[model samples]
Every structure is written in C-alpha cells, then in structure tokens.
Target: MITQLPDDFRFSGPSMELCTLTVRVADLADRFRFTLVHWGDQLGPATAMLVKLESGRDAALTEFRYAIERHGMKGPVVEVEAQDVAAVGVAALVDDVLGALRLSREDTDWIAPAENKARALDLLHWWAQTSWDDMHPRSEQRE
Candidate 1:
C-alpha cells in the first residue's frame, strides 16, 4: 500500500536511527497528544504508541486525529533519532513528542480531566485504525 520513489515518497523507513512521530494538540492548547507511528527498525507496537497527552479534563484522545490533521502544518510530522527518547510510555512518549517539537510543559499540557477514560481510549483505538478507511477509493479497490 506504499509507493517507493527515490525521493517523492510520502512515507519511508523503519529508519534505523530515527522514529517518525505524528503529533497534535487539542482544545485550545488545553490538551496535547501524539503517536509514534514508526520507531527504529519497526512500526509502533500494536497498543503501545497511541496515547494522547492532554492538560485539562477533556476528551483529548477523542479529538486527537482531527486536531493533528486540521491544525498541522509542516510542524507535526517530525523525525527523532532513537538515542533521544530513552524511555517509553504515556508520559515518556508525550515528553518525547514535546521535546521533538521544542515545546515545554508550559507550552503544552501533559494531563487532563477525562470524563470517561474507557470511552476515550476506545474511540482513540477506533480512529487509529479507521481514520484512513474512509479515504479509500472503495469502488476502485473492489475491482
């Protein structure tokens, strides 16, 4: 499902030295979220890299993709060398994202009030998988 061109590619690597990150902040800077889509030598683990980082009691995960895609410019997609992020998990991962962006805690929120954590996580998982489904050319692919 990916094309390989010399330099005209939209995606590349399992980079041995860099991890590609996609990040977004939501709710007027009240929340922050990110995803580690690719890490050195591997794509993100099935359930480990999709956490949303936020600052207020809101559905940060719920709004993650929209915020990223809508608010994103040339800033959201970044490449981080592996040696920089020495740890992983929600806090570490978010911190890694913020660090990559050169953002500080004052610039972004790391926690938020979630109304329903379960629901928000569920929606996040759904979005992670289905976000691209709607963009598929259904009829063309059917053939």
Candidate 2:
C-alpha cells in the first residue's frame, strides 16, 4: 500500500486554474495508480475533475475502463464536477478511483492527508462560487 507520493512524481507550472495530482506504480500484476486533474475558472460555476490512469499501466487501465462502464460512465477519463467533490470529499474521490481500478486502500500506496484534502475541497468550493471579476489569482511564488 502507498502511504506517500512516489519520489519521482512532481508538479510544475501554473496552478491557479488547474491542479493535477498523480500516483505511480513500479510493478505489474494489475497494480495501478491514478491521475486526477481538476480545473476551473471564475467564469465557470463547476470545476472539471478528470480521473485517469497513469501511463503504461495497461492492466489497471483496462480494469478501470470496465469498472466505469459498469457504472455507466465512459472509459479512461471520468469527468465529475465541483458539486460532486463538495458532496463526497477528496478522500471519497480517491476511493472511487481506486475502486474503479479494482483496488483498495489496503493494497494501494497514496498520500492524501485529511487536512490537505479538506483544504483542496474548500478551495474547489470557493472557486465554484466566486466570479471571474471577484477572483484573485494565487501568488505564483507560493506553492
């Protein structure tokens, strides 16, 4: 199980309108990791949350596709909205993705602290409610 982000994973570039979080796996055997990209602007009332499988993980990807299919969603990238995030919480989002991948927390290793996840959900809610004119971009100097 993963308890932290992989050492090689990193984030770069602007983050005001988008956040991409990823988990990576090093072996086969149907093991998988996920990439979640959330994006929004003041003009849009809802943030788009795109959930995908990490590249080169074919077994996991196939399983995820089937799972989403069973759930009535299209394959590979499942798009959700800010409202879903607000209602389910960030941990639930992770759980959903892991479940689709046929994985569980006991067998996966990912880092998502309660405080950080809550803060992310709060930010999503704030972005959903704020208008473009009233929105202030976060400082580029800060993470």
Candidate 3:
C-alpha cells in the first residue's frame, strides 16, 4: 500500500478531496496548535482523507492539552500537501506531523520514532478542526 503513490502527485484540494493536516494556533508553529493530514498520503494508492485513531491517544492528548494551557488555540485545521509524504525511516509518518504543523524539534515528546504511521495521521486529523486565521496572517498579509 505504501508503494502506490503516483510520482509527482501533490496533495491539493480540501479534506473532502484528500486527507488534510489541520494545525491549531499554539502548537501550530511551536506552541498550542494542531494540523490535518490524509491517510492516503501514506505509501498507498488512495485519494481520500483518512481518519484513524492512534493507540497513543493519551500521549497526544496530553501534549495537545499542554499546548492549549500554555499558548492558547484556535481552529483545528491546516491545509497541507501530504500526498507525497512517506515514512522513509523507522519512524512513522506521524513523526512528521509536528513538523508540518510547525512544532519545534524540542517539543516532540508526544511522539517517538518507534511509532507508526497511524499515529501521525491521527494527530493531523485532531488538529484539522483548528482555526488558522488567529495564527496565520495570510489574509492580513494579502491586504
């Protein structure tokens, strides 16, 4: 399933079209935030958003809560180009979820490499519902 991704395929569109990585405001770039990612982004042959629960929900929850308490939050959604995502090493695809959300390298205690792709995908979905306007200035920047 990890070998079916078409070459040069970039993940675009909304959650309905493909999986999305929603990121909260704080942890979004490095505080309290979240992001969304598609399950089909894995080394697979799917073109839809994949929503799965991670076994380590406890850890992810704690991390998410900590961020909320420390940095405040917004929406749980973030648009990402994950169709080309992959787990090249032992670490699961979720390992990169933090990166995609903009979390710093120092705050990755919520996940470990000895993890699985499901974990990363799960995290992405959790934060997918987050608000991006509060964290990003895209609209303001454009003004």
Candidate 4:
C-alpha cells in the first residue's frame, strides 16, 4: 500500500529529467512505491510508462496500451500509464487503446506534438489534485 510521491515535486520532463521512480520491493510496505514513470522523454520512440497497475480497480481497462510485440515488452509501443477510468473521457482512454492494440497501432502517432501536449495536460491537472481519494471508497470499507 505504499505509493507516495509529493516531496515538492521537481518532475521536469520533455526530454530526460524523469524525477520519480520510488521503489521498495519486500513483499509489502515501507514506502517508496511508484512502479514506473518517465512520461516526457521517449515520447516519439515509445516508452512513456507511467504505470502502477497491481490488479487495482479490478483491472481490465484502467488506462490502456499493449504492444511490445503484443506482450513481450520491448518497443513497438508500451505507453500504458494507467489507473484512471471512471466516466470515460481521455478519448475514452483512446478507444481502449484502439481495441487491445498490438504493437504500435499508432497511438496518435506517438503524441507529444505541441509543447508535450501542454505538458501532458499540466501533469494531469497536478496529479488530479494531489492523488484525489475522496475517502477512497469509504477508505476501503474501513480496511
């Protein structure tokens, strides 16, 4: 349950300058979570991970992207970056990544065309207002 990253953010990106990749694999918690994130660089060559999918939200459609030889993970498109799909609006997350994509189905020709698309929508509206929780489903049913 450790997934943090706020330390006065300095994620300056657009061509290198990742700035966030905290990890702490020990079967559980201690802190330093975030699995992936390199959202800016490698925009044209396909490498914008931004991941965090650990069977959360019951999987299947929480942000999409598939390819990397359809399941090998090595260029050909692997821009997953998930964990957000409620009312459906990021082009319905780009038509579910063009229907289960499969190696560079051309996700908008590898986006980032205008100032990194306004800096990736201003960092997704500042991490959706600080990783919004709204009491995370009653705080996970009171844990």
- By TM-score, who's the top model here? 2
Deviating ranges (above 4 Å) for candidate 1: 1-90, 109-117, 124-143
TM-score of 2: 0.33
Model 2's lDDT to the true fold?
A: 0.36
| Overall lDDT per candidate, in order of appearance | 0.32, 0.36, 0.31, 0.30
Clashing pairs in 2: 1-109, 2-108, 2-109, 2-110
At residue 106, candidate 1 shows an lDDT of: 58
* lDDT leader: 2
lDDT of each residue in 4-56, candidate 3, tens digit only: 22233343422211112333333332333223233333333222211222321
Of candidates 4 and 3, the better by TM-score: 3
In the range 47-106, model 2's lDDT, one tens digit per residue, is 122223332111111123333335553323222344434455556655665655455555
Task: Output the lDDT of residue 126, model 1.
Answer: 63
Worst 10 residues of 2 by lDDT: 12-21
Error of 4 at 69 (Å): 12
Clashes (N, CA, C under 3 Å) per candidate: 6, 4, 35, 1
- Candidate 1 colliding pairs: 32-53, 54-111, 55-111, 56-112, 56-113, 57-113
Write down the worst ten-residue block by lDDT for model 1.
55-64
Q: How far out, in Å, is residue 139 in model 1?
A: 21
Candidate that beats the other on lDDT, 1 or 4, i.e. the better one: 1
lDDT score at residue 116, model 3, on the 0-100 scale: 32
TM-score of 3: 0.22
